[model samples]
Target: MRENKSAVLNRFFSRNTFRDIIDSTDDEIYKSVILRYVKNPENKKNVELISEIYTELKKNYRNEYYYKNTLLNKLLLGVHSINTTVALTEIPISKSKADFVLINGKAIAYEIKTELDNLDRLENQINDYYKAFDHVSVITCKENLALLENKLEIINKPIGIYVLQNNGSLSIIQKPLKYSDSLDKNIIFKILRKSEYESIIMQVYGELPQVTQFKYYSECLNLFLKVDLDKVYELFIAQLKKRTKVEKELYQNVPYELKFLTYFMDLKEADYSRLNSFLYNQFGGM
Candidate 1:
């Protein structure tokens, strides 16, 4: 019997491609592969592999979603759908990266700390992020939520706090703090939507836009299927508080289209310029 060299190469390339897509910084590429694997029943094995890879990678890294979910799961459940590793950004407080930044159309800063850490230092970190970015959020475990809440109330900042639980779940408990009087309920609702949240994260952080519209919705559904709505709601509240400032004016009350967009693409605002240039060039600069 002849050796199936081509078959071997095909399998190797398939697995490698899948790994590369998951590890890729390009959100579009990542989204496309993720969607394809998710939608096709035949690709279930690959999807499971990707999930396993995510879990294994996080295990190797101490700063995994496991740590984050443990502190916040009680308050925020929707986090299960988010790729925590990719969503979090470490930026400098004093020439250091903020612990975690949610970049959609704009940048939102967060400073994560444990209960054992110095409270004063954490406060200082929050101040630093506020100075650099328009909005700032503080994330802590359940043990510190009450203390942080009281402290924030005393300081009059009354910032929102994120509580990570031991089971990789999140609970977002608000402090009734208001940064500005102008609050839009629709934006808040949109933020609460899992699809919208994923879309925003993909756009700002993932930097990829190839996932199809159907796949985005499917992913959102899958996330919800595996998690609880209350948990998701809590996380949304936490995320909303963290990313409160809307730098640009949004004429649309809600991003209804975002739900469909989630299926096949991962888009970001920063890429608009590149997309525009590409289109312009393709259309002879018309």
Candidate 2:
């Protein structure tokens, strides 16, 4: 006879830390579960059965997970302080529900996959997301990292990659890659408007041409708007050599539109407000 899998899940969820595991310390519980299951493979069939039941629960509770992850990613990316509007569970171009959409004047779609599912669907979902959104990301646990690396070779599109453990800790496994010829104007504009253009310049140049400009722009705009300009400048210049080398070897002959970006980094303190105003006008400002 089939065991009452619900009973097993109920028992698991009833633990005082289950909610904490799901809410705050997911990676710890995830590692614990894997370790416990590995140590006690005698109960392998039971574990698989329980996992199946949890899959059903996850499907039913996907919305809850989606919202939770949005909140989680927001905190992880420090989105709240960036003045960007964030939305959750947006629809993909496929009209299937995307797990999260972060719009801080730029559209970023996030799809969350748990341990129960293969990442094949995620690859397809991210592809669809890119068609409808400006950026695409997948949030999964470390157990799925191998799968993402394998898929990355086949899907050449630039997509943000993040690991969201059972403990709710998020680590950027793969920063967003750029697949388009067009510069992400919104991100570019934000970086130009920032007081820390010098720092933004250094970090942005550190990445490969396809990724460096967009990622650096987004990161600088997202983080430096409130920090002291001097610190930002120091940090930016400190990494300049590394960025310069990366640009020469990996992103030679960078597009003219993006090259204009380098100019913002060299501006005088008195010139920042005017340069920002110029950039805002050029990009039609967010």
Q: What is the C-alpha lDDT of each candidate?
A: 0.42, 0.45
lDDT of predicted model 2: 0.45
Candidate that scores best on TM-score: 2
lDDT minimum window of 10 residues, candidate 1: 251-260
Stretches of candidate 2 off by over 4 Å are 1-67, 70-78, 178-286
- Model 1 CA deviation exceeding 4 Å by range: 1-65, 68-88, 175-286
- Give the C-alpha miss distance for residue 131 in model 2, angstroms: 1.1
TM-score of 1: 0.36
* Whole-structure CA lDDT of model 1: 0.42
* Deviation from native of the Cα of residue 79 in model 2, angstroms: 3.8
Work out the TM-score per prediction.
Answer: 0.36, 0.40
